[model samples]
Target: MWWFLICLAALIGGYFIYGSFIERIFGINEKRATPAYTQQDGVDYVPLPTSKVYLVQLLNIAGVGPIFGPIMGALYGPAALLWIVIGSIFAGAVHDYFSGMLSIRNNGASVPSITGKYLGNSPRHFMNVFAIILLVLVGVVFVSAPAGMLTNLINEQTSLHLGTGAMVVIIFAYYILATIVPVDKIIGRLYPVFGALLIFMSVGLMTAISFSGEHTIMPGFQFGDMFSNLNPHDMPLWPALFITIACGAISGFHATQSPLMARCMENEKNGRFVFYGAMIGEGIIALIWCTISLSFFDSVDGLADAVSHGGPGNVVYTSSFGLLGVFGGILAFLGVVILPITSGDTAFRSSRLILAEYFNLEQKTLKSRLMMAMPLFVIGGILTQVDFGIIWRYFGFANQSTAVIMLWTASAYLIRHQKLHWITSIPALFMTTVCISFILSSQTLGFGLPMQISTILGFIGSVAVLAYVIKVAGKHKNLSHSDKATDNLTRIT
Candidate 1:
């Protein structure tokens, strides 16, 4: 209980501190003139109200990762709680806040654009390519995992014969409706109602599971046991942790949310509320999932059994509605249906933005529309045949690598602008070191990559980008001068 309280405090404090820093470094004055980036008037680039922006940002960033990552992390037992708390604060929150703020300052550009600005054109292209590939990969797994869970849940609870194809259709329909509809008319009304119902369902299910007196099977592995029992084929702990943290860490999805939401900032001051606030909310979601997993299942085998034997759905359903009886179960079903909608809309919108930017197309054109939907449809089709577990792992690794590159870009920006505070740079350096080490170790261990081929390629990609960033940092001589002038004015005032 005390640990939980401590974790909560850390989450809250970290957001406030890091979010403030991001706002300050980016010169995100509410009074600053809006940059003349051609924003589309419709769903793609239409300026949203601040509240809607926050809500959308929250929903987009919060996905299946928070739910599943914590469960898997709990395999390490209570100690994993420490990682969730600390790593989320230092690694995840910081990555998100700065990434969003940087994108905002760069005229709603994506991370790759921001990278191109600070790095070089070639590196930016590479980063963008990596980001898009990762986005597609992660997007598919993201849709599939939840679909799998939803399928299992429906089968366990009701007589509904929801196949993966049917679920995909439902998701696509929801995305179409949400994207084309006015924000005020749909998301604004539906989110609060749905969010409340979800909370109720989660609480009800958890309470029921608690009172059911079903003892959680505690797996017998000690803290040190995992070290000795490390499968020769498995990657080491640090790398696994790094990759696993990608969803919570920095994700390319943030690139989409930041710029789009930045346009609605009633005041630049609101950046904190939107960027960091969303992350803290996500952390709470993750914590809730962790509690659910830790309290319900005592053993790894128990969890595996729940997932393997069609019990994953029962676990979600039973835990969700079993507390309130039949009505609660019905509500749980509705919540499952809604959860994917939030993420699916995000993916659709993000793909649209990436394509619009890639080809320099007007956002509303038929070409942009077809371009956006095509990738999603293609990815969805591929996901139906692939092993999602393996795909998700690869996505996770790719996400972390992209995040590290973004962090490097941000650090370079700060240094060039003479705002390179130790608070930010220290964590940035630490995360970068951890990520690089993890990627190397993953190759060494028989995790993937035929004989370090992938590792070598990733290394080359990273170095080329780093060298470009260094060159850009050196070349941006005027940035330091401008920052100094601003400081001088501040002191005079």
Candidate 2:
């Protein structure tokens, strides 16, 4: 009951406090100027209402990462939830909000572009390459786990043997609709219904689980026991926790999603609401998943077996909805279907943006869009054969590494703009320090001295990149001053 109340408080606080920030930061109000380059159309570039934008951001950001991050965090005990909540608001939400705002200010340019503006060309390119590699790793590992869970849910409910084939069909259908149908027509109208259904089903499942009187799964380790679980073979708690939180803290995908959302913002002020607000909602979703995992499963082995065998062979969802019996099963199935669609759509849109930016493809054509998405579809299909659990850990690490780069960029932006609020920089700095420390620790303790040496080299490389960013910032400031002086002289003449 306390947990429920906590969650409700987080949601209400997020909507009101963070929602107001959105209006202040990105709203269409007169305080912030809209980018002149934003080409507003009734379709792709159309400005959405704040509520609609919030829903899209929520759906786009609420992927498997949130679900799995909390589950991993729960390994450290319920105390981890405290970090998840605080970090979501401070570190995660701030990073996401700024990334979107930067993209919008630069005409929907990607993080790589923003990095180049503040950092040098070489560092920008390096970060972009790193981000793509991380994203691909993420796609390979993280994309299929939810699909597996969804398949299991369908199979258990209908006694139908849904497999990767079913997953493929569903993903393909979403892509087709996203590509063929107009964004304005489909997103505001149909997508909200899907979003509402997902929320309803998730809530219903939680309620059913609570009332069913099933054995509640608790964290295996106490707070003190977390470090003791560190083993040479099994990934240690510190590193694992670091990676998991890093994904939540900062992600390259946030960069992609921000720009996509920026295209739909009615004004710059909406950034706070859409970008930060959505992140808070995503954090809440992660919290719920973690809570469910902790409350439902008895042991680590049981949870592993469930993940390995397609999410407890769907019995978990079915049993979760036990309150409504058959009706609950139906709701569970609908939720299962909706989860993948939300993620798949976001992936499709993001991949399109990346391709359009990198290859300079014409986004208006059907062939161009299909070509952009083909690689992801092909790779996703192949990855279905591999073990996702092990891969997911690596993805978490790589995703965090990407986030580190974004934090670097965002922190630089904050400094350059002289908006160096401690609320923003402190969280960014803390997450950056955590990520770098974990990488160093992973190399030293986990991978030995030689790996540690490589990690040090990576750290050096990051420092060099930071130096380059500082140099560019200095140059940009000088240029701004020079331009202002020239304008004054012209006025005097």
Candidate 3:
């Protein structure tokens, strides 16, 4: 319990100390005019108060990933807790900080566009396809997850037998409206309310856990215990846990989502609050879910059995219902229906912006916005029919893969200016190895290769990528005017 409290404090302190350090390294310039004003489309590039943008950014990236991802990761035991704390402080927050700040630096460019500018055209094109597919997967997964929870909630409460398909349609309708409308219309208005629910849900669940008479499966924390692989399914701890317990840790999905809030930010100084602070908030949420999942189930095996039986959604619903009672049921609705819906809308919204950038179409017109959003909905509509569990697995791989790209991109940005590139460079290399090993391990996201061979290959791949990143950074390129405007970039508030 003491260790858990310490980890919680670490996450909060990371925001004040580490977040500020990253902000300084990036050289935030409050003097530069942001896209919200310079290119205020009132649609996508509309400016908002920093507090409002923080809430919007929190909901946009929070979704259900912080909940479901960590819940699934709890099957691996307390290691998930450590990952949520450590990864968020060192990697996740850094990834998100750069994702938004770099976009702000580049006229609110999307992830692919910024990556292309720093890493060259190959990655830009790869990220174009990669980010789009990941966003669609996130959209489809969020759509189906909430729809499933809603389906169960409705069936249990009323005699209504609404299927997941019906709920998906309702969600899709909302997504289309959220995607095509101006930034202030649907998302901006409701995000603060939704973000509040997300935090309250976690805190409510934590209070329930603390007062429960049930025997918790949680073991006393030891320094070495966090790294032990306790997964019942024999999954490797190195890459699989890192990949499974995403979003709360370090997610590439956040990178794509960051640019959405980037365009809405009123100043560069707000980047730390809206981007890095939101990730730390998610880490807290993920930690709560992971802790309660372990406590409520009584054993890691029991949690795994529950997961194997009905998936993460079932685990979330059961724990919420058992611990919090009738009110728990209501929060379950919010967890399944509201949280994911908030993220789903922004997922599609970001996709619309990215597709517009792909086609070089100005998003100033309603017609152009619709043109970009239509295809994402069609693809999401088709994919929602394909099980949420499978979609989530694929999304995790793509999510982390995208994070690696964003990390490397940030490293390139820092290295190009010769301003302490190691902060991002180290994480980029570590995640690059994780991604490499994950895709080749033949276990979860990889091919049918032996673990030893997969690990060796991952090492080789990381080295090659490291060499390439250094070479790219070494090119005699000029930092953008925004990167040089304020060298101190110091503001505590």
Candidate 4:
């Protein structure tokens, strides 16, 4: 519990200290008009209040991620604590800040466009396709999980005629309507309500933890304990820990969501609060969930047994029900049902924006918006029929893979402008290692190589990629012949 409080404080303090420092590095200029104000498209580039944008962004990046991921991540014991704090401060917040600011600087362009601008055409094209696919996977996963939960919840209550398939169709209909409409219509208004419920649920659980008198549940952290896997499967601590806990720490998908808020931000200064602050807020939520999950079950082994018997959803349900009784059940429903539904809506919306930006299609018109979104939703609907585990597996790897690309792109943008590129470059290289190592070592995919071999190959691959990026950035600088163009890009946008 003391460890949990310390981590929570560290995340808050990191926001004021490290978060502000990153903002300074990015050079937020207040005088310049943001895309929301400058472009002012009624459909897409509408300016929103800072508070609303923050809530929308929070709900966008969060969904069920911070809840489910951290619960599963706690399988590794105290090591999850270290990653949530350090990764959120240095890696996750920074990744989100730069991605959002970069989008704002590029007229609210999608990640592919921004990446293309810095990393050149090939990577941009790749990011365009890759980001869309990732978003689609996210959309499908969120859709299926929540829709199924709702179906069960309803079926259990009364003999509802609705099946999971019918629920999917109903939810996807809402998703389509939300995706094609203006930002402020459905998402902007409803997000603050959803965000409030999420915060309420988190606070309730945290309060329950404080008064539970469950001292025997949460174990003290020790140096030796940090290195050992507490998970039943003995999952390796390096890449598995990092991958299992991507959202609370850092995730590539945040880059995709950043532009959504970027388009709605009324001022460049708001990016810090909306983007970086939201990620920090998510870290706090993840931290709370981690502690609750570890302590609520009486022991890590007990928690692992429950997880094995049910799933992460079981962890959430049993923990919440155990701690808060009827209220906890309500919170459980929100965590399992409402959270994922909200995330699914934004996932599809972000997908629409990605494709629209890729094709330079205007989203103000109904026809254009539908043209960009119809096929994407169709594909997502088709995928909802496939196995959720397969889609989730691919999404986990792909999520970090996209993060590697965004980080390197931000690093290149800094390099071309003669700024401190290592801020992003270092994390980029680190995540590169994580992604590569996870692929090589994961049983679900890649060669089931030993951890030692995977670690070595991951290190080599990451450094090589970093070197290649540096070369490309250097060549781009030489060809462009001036930092003036980079400066102009920001100024004009």
RMSD of candidates 1 onward, in order? 5.0, 5.3, 2.7, 2.3
Best-first order by lDDT: 3, 4, 2, 1
TM-score of 2: 0.80
Separately for all candidates shown, the number of backbone clashes (residues 3 or more apart, or on different chains) is 5, 11, 1, 0
TM-score of each: 0.81, 0.80, 0.95, 0.95
State candidate 3's TM-score. 0.95
Off by over 4 Å in 2: 3-37, 41-43, 134-143, 176-181, 209-235, 245-250, 298-319, 322-324, 421-424, 433-472, 478-493
Error of 3 at 186 (Å): 1.1
Model 1 lowest lDDT segment of ten? 484-493
Q: Which runs of model 3 end up more than 4 angstroms from their true locations?
A: 215-224, 443-445, 477-493
Tens digits of per-residue lDDT, candidate 4, 28-61, equal 8876788887778888788888988988888888
lDDT of each: 0.60, 0.60, 0.84, 0.84
Q: lDDT of model 3 at residue 204?
A: 82
Residue 456 displacement (Å), model 3: 1.7
lDDT of 3 at 405: 93
Displacement of the residue 163 alpha carbon in candidate 2, Å: 3.4
Worst 10 residues of 2 by lDDT: 484-493
Per-residue CA lDDT of model 2 for 1-493, tens digit only, reads 4664585587558657855663454323334334322455444566667777778776766656665566666555554566667767767787788788877666667777777766668767876676565555554543465566667666666868867667756666665567434467776667667667767776776676566666553434455532354222365554356566544434556665676667777666567767877787777666666666656665555555455554432434534564457776766656645654665566656665665777776666777777877776676667656676556656666666666667677766655655443444465455554555565556433444344554465556556655655565655554455324422311101
